[model samples]
Target: MKQKPIHPALEPYLEGKVLLVNKPLHWTSFDAVRKIRGFSRITKIGHAGTLDPLASGLLIICTGKFTKKINEYMGMEKEYTGSITLGASTPTYDLESEPENQQDISHITEEMIHAATAQFTGPIMQVPPSHSAIKKDGKPVYLAARKGIDVELEPRPITIYSFEITRIELPVVHFKVVCSTGTYIRSLANDYGKALGVGGYLSSLCRTRIGNFSLEYALSVDAIGAEIQHLKNSYIPPAGGYTDAV
Candidate 1:
């Protein structure tokens, strides 16, 4: 395979840099950052936001001085597209848990799905899932949940910029959502099921955008590593190392 040239600017990762990476499925946000760190000597790197291992999409990675702006980038609104399966609920609110309490979805209609979205639009009170990474007593709630411990959580306000139905099967609903930074789409799925009087759980999720960054422009792990290698070998050199005459 032909090697792609590295951008001139990426060589100075220690100074500061921002990279748009397309996170792969089953990979945590930190996993992507670790791969990038391996490509360079810079160790101040951090991802602007977190994506669950089950979700894949745009991940903004910052190095050196740019790491300070992670919170700012994380606060921006996000866009996601995914499928939710109705008529069954899960302990984790997604396929990560076993499907339970199946209900008849034959009675659900497209009109009902469209009309139900109105209730979730704009400002709404949302409760995060119990199996989430939220902290309780200085420990992650999911950790407690895995031990069969029940945790009480209060509803917090979140804004849903827009919610649209992209497709529908009897028990599966594919949709797009633009929501605030703290919004949990899993909660939205659970609430949506309650609205229709049929339990539901998230089956698949893919984040498409974050603020102005889109996954379409992101590079894969291998592509990024290769670019970094190219930069170090073909361009950058050690401070005391001298090159041969051109």
Candidate 2:
């Protein structure tokens, strides 16, 4: 059997490296990690946080020894920018499920929308969407939800440091949020709409920051793959032929 080549460029990844990835829409956080692991061939790799397939944005990928810091990163505050579609609610609280229970947003003024945010700001108890990965009876709650089974979830306390309304176009409301680690923007959207006496759901979401790490520094999955390939191509075997150990 042939051993894999060891390149100096790849050494840092093995020792430990924190990578910022711009997770693509419909791609789970694990998808990005799997791609990086496949290309880099690093067995010890994990992401700092989980991003739903419906959302896209900054995903912190820790490799090798850096994987230990996953919890630390996960505890950091997160920032997101997205739009909430009012006048309808979804079972999933987002586009993951079909919108239902439509309402009229004609009377929903900008003043009312802005006021709604204040109620959600600061500390609040949020009930996660039914179509979520939260565990119940050793199974994901979403599984039972898909089977049309109701699984009552307790409201968990979360803090919203800030919730700023950026734009308003009747049914579509654009906003930015900075919140605690476990805060769910989907729930925020839903609650905000209900506060205004109209239904709402998360239409689009993008995480822009996690603590000091920003999406601005993130690279796409393909870009990271190209980097790994470049490193491999630049490797040169020893003069006496490659050895088994580095």
Best prediction by lDDT: 2
TM-score of each: 0.91, 0.94
Q: Which runs of model 1 end up more than 4 angstroms from their true locations?
A: 1-11, 236-246
Tens-digit per-residue lDDT, 121-173, candidate 2 = 89889998878888988999999999999999899999999999999987999
Please identify model 2 stretches exceeding 4 Å from their true place: 1-8, 237-246
Inter-residue clash pairs, candidate 1: none
Q: Model 2: how far is 219 from its true place, Å?
A: 0.2
Q: Every model's Cα RMSD, please?
A: 5.1, 2.7
- Per-residue C-alpha lDDT of model 1 across residues 92-188, encoded as one tens digit per residue: 9887889999899888889998899999999999999999889988999999899999988889999999999999986899999999999998889
In terms of lDDT, model 1 sits at: 0.86
